[model samples]
Target: MMTIERLREEINKIDEEILSLLNSRASCARQIGELKQKNSLVTYHPAREKEIYRQLLATNHGPLSYDTICAIYTEIISACRGIESPLKIAYLGPEATFTHMAARRKFGSSVEFVPVASIADVFAEVEKKRADYGVVPIENSTEGVITHTLDMFIESNLTICAEILLEISQCLLSNSSLEEIRLVYSHSHAFAQVRGWLKSNLPTTKCIEVSSTAEASRRAAMEQDSAAVGSELAAQVYHLNIMAKGIEDRVDNYTRFLIIGHSMVGRSENDKTSIMFSVKDRVGALHSMLSPFNKHNVNLTKIESRPSKDTIWEYIFFIDMNGHIEDDNVKEAIDELRESCLYLKVLGSYPVAG
Candidate 1:
């Protein structure tokens, strides 16, 4: 009983309304950008960005899924943010690496992505301001912490602006058939992730380490009888066939990446604070440092200790707690901690990964 012309007419009207509303939003964003510029403020605000997503998700009632809604807004924000200033980001790369994927997930496809060779390089790019920000892998749910990233934090003055949690699924990519894969190539981390699968299926294949998964794909694409363990993005980039998908030993693998920048993120509704400090090498010393977090009623989400690299057995502890650095209880707790620690550094306070 419904007329197609009537439906088409309604859709046309809706399209005009959508365009008008988008322009209005862009105008407002540009005005905000002018104010930020006048105030000498950084154009990219991860805390405000997180709040935008949170508010949108809370209001969304859909035929569209949560991911779909997020994707729509990500590009919209990215485009409008570009009008204020286009962001240039560095990531651990040859391109198509998980860190690269995480960077894209946060900033969207509208901005520039620069691929650097090492975790240190990623840090350097942000520190030198060659790149506005950088994304580096910090830890994997499967293989544990990236010590290099942790080490970089010890020296680099950059703050952790945000964190990204990516669900990692590797693919076996090759130009030839399974029978032809005589050698396996992957980053050392990637090999660790899918070691059991390689041992079970291609035990006879000689495995080699590369700088990154993307680098492995590059080698595999050129070398005969070689396959790469990498993201599906790598397969597409190199025009290689994905002989097997989700080839990792563990299916539930996840990796956490950190966004590093010169400026720290402001407080968000839900936040996590990370800090590093060294305590006297004595009994109950570590306990004395952590006591304030308990006294302040803060929940400690993560804690890690790395050797100070200056003296034997001397170490600095890194703690991530639930709450912003600006929060009264968190500030009181950290100040209390300062008395016990020989040296203290607030690494960052950012919105917790949703």
Candidate 2:
């Protein structure tokens, strides 16, 4: 049998090798970053990162699980990218908010997180070249799409470079016991998500809506008889105790966040393109326009409509399809789609959320 000391020695050798390899990787990344800056190219390449993740996961034969390996490499990539300069990620935040969490999850700890006031501000920051990228909530599993985020895309001149799917787990945080909790604070969305649970558990607790979960946590931390419904991170940030965890009514609450940037992302191994179009006013016009997708054998994952803020009674159709914009079939389908439409816009083509 192998001795413990021998096994440790082997591990130490591997550790030294990993350290050397990481520094070498970071040096290469720095060179790439310099080239990118010289040529005015985008440093945060989502497609390249996605491809790396795909390759690593495919070859990962582990004592560690798939998620563990992914997480490890994500940080490794983040660190390498930071060697040039830490990417500034603007997110909707007060801090400890879900969007902030998603941004951190995607970019890892090596980057900087700038908290913005609203979704519009997130777009403005990226558009003005202030933030390297902006993350905004696109949709939620339980509550459906965020209209404000969809609305911002209408005129924002930004592109979706990546997508983040964050599993939202709400916690009941308080300084006092459940019975002692008289007032509950959280964002309106959180309150809505856990309304059923709240009604059953703390029927008389005064529920107040706050700007963000971080703000709610602050209030909870200050108040003697208050509780907050948010993440465990929020609890930690504000020094509140987690009274209960996973308190949302639905077990599978999830929020999808979009990474927005000035430039378009290149195609990844598996890609999804988002597009929006306004149809001409005619009977059967909408039906005829959609046929091309089916005829071209393009698979549309989602279709949503928002009132065209430009014209009254008119609507814009936002579509998510299972291919890149550079694909021949995708191009053909869009060309066919444009023939009957008043206006068409490609939002972005990016790697589908893992």
The per-model lDDT (C-alpha) reads: 0.90, 0.91
Residue 32, candidate 1: how far off, in angstroms?
1.2
For model 2, the local distance difference test gives: 0.91
Candidate 1: C-alpha RMSD to true structure equals: 1.6
Clash pairs detected, candidate 2: none
Per-residue lDDT value at 277 in model 1: 89
- Residue 75 displacement (Å), model 1: 1.0
What TM-score does prediction 2 earn? 0.96
Off by over 4 Å in 1: 1-13
Clashes of each: 0, 0
Tens digits of per-residue lDDT for model 2, 157-255: 899998999999999999999989999999999998999999999999999999988899999999999999999889888999999889899998999
